[model samples]
Target: MGAAYEGLSEKTRTRRFLASVLHLTETMLDHLVDDVDGVDHVALALVGVGDDRVGVPTAIAR
Candidate 1:
């Protein structure tokens, strides 16, 4: 998820996070991960196939 967030375009990041720069600080990531309810709310989609997969999330809702 962190990788996916980092891969977002500047425009998309700004729109989604309402910030010119989206910084996923360790503290922020920790908070997100610690939120059990938030875990349930998140959704992600990755590209590529199987064990060789490598990609960013195409969509997210949280």
Candidate 2:
């Protein structure tokens, strides 16, 4: 993935990968929050966005 994204400018590549991962991650979390009983997502904290992946805190809730 890093090799594939190397052709893109640094800023665009970072944004594109982060957006893709975040979309997939948010979709999974949405499903979990919706299917499980008494479950709620409080916040999403993104610590960093790397070339191949993103660093984000997992779902937190009461």
- Measured with C-alpha atoms, the lDDT of residue 56 in candidate 1 is 47
Instruction: Write the residue-wise lDDT of candidate 2 on 1-62 in tens digits.
Output: 33444566667756755553322354554664454444443433446557879765653433
TM-score of each: 0.47, 0.22
Residue 15 error, candidate 2, Å: 0.7
Compared with the true structure, the alpha-carbon lDDT of candidate 1 equals 0.69
TM-score for candidate 2, please give it.
Answer: 0.22
lDDT of 1 by residue, 1-62 (tens): 78888899999889976778677888878766654454555545455445766564465445
